[model samples]
Target: LQQLRSLGQPPRPVTSTACVPRRSKEVPLCPMEQPGETQDAAALPGPTRWPLLGSLLEILWKGGLKKQHDTLAEYHRKYGKIFRMKLGSFDSVHLGSPCLLEALYRTESAHPQRLEIKPWKAYRDYR
Candidate 1:
């Protein structure tokens, strides 16, 4: 380590008076960008919000599950296959194609371990 230190006093800084060119005369932003483009939260839809309670009112009124049957039925009738539904900040993917069943039913030897448990079991245990 001493032998290496003998070879160098860190290189001297070089100073130049050249002014850096501005890209567009706009405010500079960090190169590390956010995941998605920044947008105003007010412009984004939260829920069919009312005056005071915002989305919580609808959720409380429905006892949690949104009345989503109408939208799903409508999409199936119109799209005839697959469609996406936005439900209280969560997404529900609906697949209408017959191939969807085929894909689920077909099994391979190397298929991953399935954690198949009935949904009612959880509710029963909770109760």
Candidate 2:
């Protein structure tokens, strides 16, 4: 079919850098400063980002391991699917929908490399 031929054709690769038009440095482009904002700034929430630790503290404060799983699930329930949460000081996870999580688990795509450890940390180690 014509559509299949089009799909088979090689697509263009994206260039990392493109020439951008230079603008005057004097004029600052503050896109956020617009008139008559309808949205509430505070209520437009993310995963409880703090001053020093950001959401890292929140994740730690909830305890680690299974606790993190529970909290992430809770947040998913409250904030819909695809919610952002911290995992210790170094990691921020954007957890997908329940269906996606299930699919990942079913496909063995969730941290497949973690199984190679001498002593597995998670319950899935038994597999």
Count backbone clashes in candidate 1. 0
Per lDDT, the best of the predicted structures is: 2
lDDT of each: 0.37, 0.41
TM-score of each: 0.30, 0.37
Residue-wise C-alpha lDDT for candidate 2, range 1-107, written one tens digit per residue: 01111223232222221211143211111123232122322333357766566676666678855597776767777765444443345333343444334322333
Q: What lDDT score is found at residue 124 in candidate 2?
A: 70
Candidate 1 per-residue C-alpha lDDT over 74-117 given as tens digits, one digit per residue, 9 for 90 to 100: 54686545444444454333445544322222321233344455
In model 1, where is the ten-residue run with the lowest total lDDT?
Answer: 24-33
Off by over 4 Å in 1: 1-67, 104-127
Local distance difference test, candidate 2 = 0.41
